[model samples]
Target: MNLADVPKEKLSPMMQQYAATKEKYSDCILFFRLGDFYEMFFEDAILVSRELELTLTGKECGLDERAPMCGVPYHSVDLYLKKLVDRGYKIAICEQMTDPALSKGLVERDVIRIVTPGTLIESSMLDDNANNYICSLYYGTDGSCALCFADLSTGEMSLAVPQGTTDLTVRIMDMLSRYTPAELVLNAQALSLKSVMDFVKVRLQCAVTLRDDACFSLDTGRELICQQFGVDSLELLGIEEDGAGACAVCGMLDYIRETQKRNIARFISIDVVDSAETMGLDLNARRNLELTETIRGKERKGSMLWLLDDARTAMGKRLLKTWMEQPLVQPLKIMARLDAVEAFYKKSVSLMEVRALLDNVYDLERLMTRGLFQKASRKPHRVT
Candidate 1:
């Protein structure tokens, strides 16, 4: 069969299924597993090859001609996946659902997972000291809505119901700092709220989930909460809809149930406080003063992670992780941790001085990557 003579109208069942899957997840890079490699086709092939620095190639699809294709070996998927995610791309992993040897017809193909930066669970892609968050919003019957957000990695949870304009910004900002959610959910009717959410989304490169109009009711919020936690009613959680707070809390829990991939059996104790309870810091100050920006680059050999290595004790390492999880909260706790850090700094024979340090360390992206990869050259003695 000639290369150009492949019948466009006579595509095999497997080819048809692949085309349908491609259409279903148009926005995502579909990693279609064929055998040893995760393959990309047509435009996905071109785009992925260029972005990932992989070789561009083609495959014979049992037709008169070859189809455009590019692929990376299954074992090296994590490396390429990390690169794509770091560049802010969502991936839909489409695996062959059935064994080719056992199945009679075309090999079954289905999307097994959708990977995003914030939803990542692999230890290599995540920081032990940082939290990955997913958030959802529910608009009530009135002109109000509840925002629910959770971080499964660290088991942190938070809720906020902002009524007027003043509280809205404060609440949203507070939630942003408190949870650092990677994705957000909201109803279509909540345009104003969506605008605020969008600002956060773009600035933080977060994902958003817009609910259908049919599910925009307050009862839906409660039902979602009940369903997520597998409770018969909200009463079991000691929460009632006396006001908007319950709806907000329930909506967040519901969002978590729908989106979270893992069964997080344990939750870390979260100390809840209003934005007013803590001193407000501007976005610039928060990012710069706290060293949040240092962790944005390559995984290992970053600055924040470097500081964590020199933390000297388990408590210090735990504190460092907590700082990355909720960079804006618990100033007192951070100060206490800083004191411990300072004691170590003074005693250690490092060239850097302790007196020049600021309240919150800056260049966070650098710090985190460095700390994540830190390892001792030799085994240390185990102390009793």
Candidate 2:
């Protein structure tokens, strides 16, 4: 096959399979595995090379004149993957499904794993004390979908049903602050829900999916919630909801069950907090100051593990998770923690001393494993 003979409009079957995988994982940088190296094609090549600092090469695809390609060795995928993820890119890991020697036709390829900022479970890429979150969206029968999220690492769970388009953005922003989920899932037909999710994806550098089967009916949500909690109704949990809320709640539980990490989220708190009531911080500011970057160089010196070392009680650990998850919200809670630190500082403790105290806090997975962990303790010391 020569480059001049390749058709421009339609792709070949192999290329079509690649395109399908790419479309299914548009939000992710699809690491399409061809052989020893994880190959990326076309725009994915451009994006991955630029992000992962790899050499941009080209590969012959039938008659195509060496289509753009870039790749990383399978052994070193984690480092490049972490770099891309740290820079906020979800990666869909496409692997060879069958042994090439055993297969008669083109080597089988399938996406065995999808890595998102929040849904990361790999120990090397995560902190031990942190939580990873996956968000689920369920619209009611009346074109209303509730957003429910859970982070199993720290056992944080929350649900919110946006009333209309006007509330959807704010509701999502609020959830962003509270959960900071790595991935978001929504109903396929929920266009409004999808739009809101897209906005969040752009803002948070996260992954979003539209799954029709995931959205449960209102009665179904209620039934799941009741069954999970072993209660007759939601009223037992002090949850007062119309039919819509019931469905949303149930859809959330169903997703959690399907994910097969039953004990990951221990149901610490559930509330109907309005986004308007919370302080507004854009996604960029939140991610920079809280997650990837430090408020000051001094605080970055220690491990998150060290910070939690002094947390003697379960309540303290839970408080630590809450702070990590919603770093920008609950000002009163953050202030209290700051006040505690200030008291320690007042005892002739040098800033370097505090930095040294935090030096042992190094569990990235544990720190970010749950949705409720916050890094406010390391914020620059406020005088007043």
Candidate 3:
């Protein structure tokens, strides 16, 4: 039902609050925090009920029409949130901002987090080995595009700016396939760019969010980068001043800020990737090489990685994948890696004992990440 058709005075006090908040995030499903449940109302209720197989119900909101409703317990909300996010839908979590017992009127609340396919940090919602990335694309007027990828789960951030070549579509698709972002954010105005837009919509088929074109700005973006990375110069981070990469990063922060509604201490640490020094591989090359999977039907059983991967821990497995994707182009770095491997090879007696010990080890990387995030925002400083 069109909520606008109902008179504002007809809504209950609580529902008036809901309607106001809903207007701002119309594209997303609002999970209003009740006492112990995350409630969805109106059309959002009907939609998620069918999608998540929740019981469809109704609530009397004092309006001419009864509001549709569905809900899940707050403790088990992650399961429901994952379902919507997996289906490419965004969810705004309206939280009680104050102690409900102390409040005289209705409990004061606001949306604390707007969860999207990207920007998820909870361990249960993410994969152990694969990185969860949220990327922003800036289509420049000069026929070039600047893309920024940020993995909040791992605190990894990188930017790439390249002009359209004869094989522009393939190159763009290759870059997308390489990282495999959970969501792609772009300017609403750029949807008119037929060829490029079609690739994002059809070929990629990932979640795409369109924001106002005015939200992306070179100066604002540079400031955001400087604030986040604590750098005075963009060039220091390998991002050009007033360039496409800069614009893309700015756009990314914009969407993140709008959704998260809080500080992103996890993403404060950033890395400027040197794409030139790494070997580049496309999707086709990855499949043909069978680096991580078999060529016959793409399973892990007969792959090169399957045979070579004797990794005992999650971090080791992730590092192995990195090695498979980007072999060192510099001879010095390559030699250093070879020397390390050679040392391991010669330690025949110690290597077997070490591997046996590591088989019982836990995933330290993700455990430390969750610990640091949940316990405190400030990370412990390293000793020099």
* Candidate 1 Cα outliers beyond 4 Å, as residue runs: 1-9, 61-65, 138-141, 163-167, 190-198, 208-221, 230-232, 235-277, 291-384
Backbone clash count for every predicted candidate, in the order shown: 28, 41, 0
Instruction: Give the Cα error of residue 24 in candidate 2, in Å.
Output: 3.9
| lDDT per residue as tens, model 2, 1-384 | 322234644566677677777777776788888778888888889888787677999876654366788888997787888788777677888889999789898788988666656555444565434456677766655555567776554445666655534565565665665666776666665556554656676755666655655356554566667666667868776566565556556655665554432432445356654544345555555545544334556243353534544553333444565555455466776688799788877876575676565554443323444323232234322111
TM-score for each candidate, following the candidate numbering: 0.67, 0.57, 0.89
Cα displacement (angstroms), candidate 3, residue 380, comes to 18
- Cα lDDT of candidate 2 equals 0.61
Error of 2 at 75 (Å): 2.7
- Summarize candidate 3's per-residue lDDT along 115-190 as a digit string, tens digits: 9998787766886656788889787777567778987766677777644444655656667767768898887645
Give one digit per residue, the lDDT tens place, for model 1 in 280-342. Answer: 544544555444445356243455545545443333454565555445457787688789768
* Cα RMSD (angstroms) for every candidate in the order listed: 8.4, 9.1, 4.1
TM accuracy, model 3: 0.89
Compare the candidates by TM-score and give the number of the best one: 3
Q: Which stretches of candidate 2 lie over 4 Å from their true place?
A: 1-13, 137-147, 152-176, 182-242, 246-319, 323-384
| Pairwise lDDT winner, candidates 1 and 2 | 2
Model 3 score (lDDT) = 0.77
Off by over 4 Å in 3: 163-166, 189-193, 293-302, 352-365, 368-384
lDDT over C-alpha atoms for residue 198 of model 3:
74
* Model 2: ten consecutive residues of lowest lDDT: 375-384
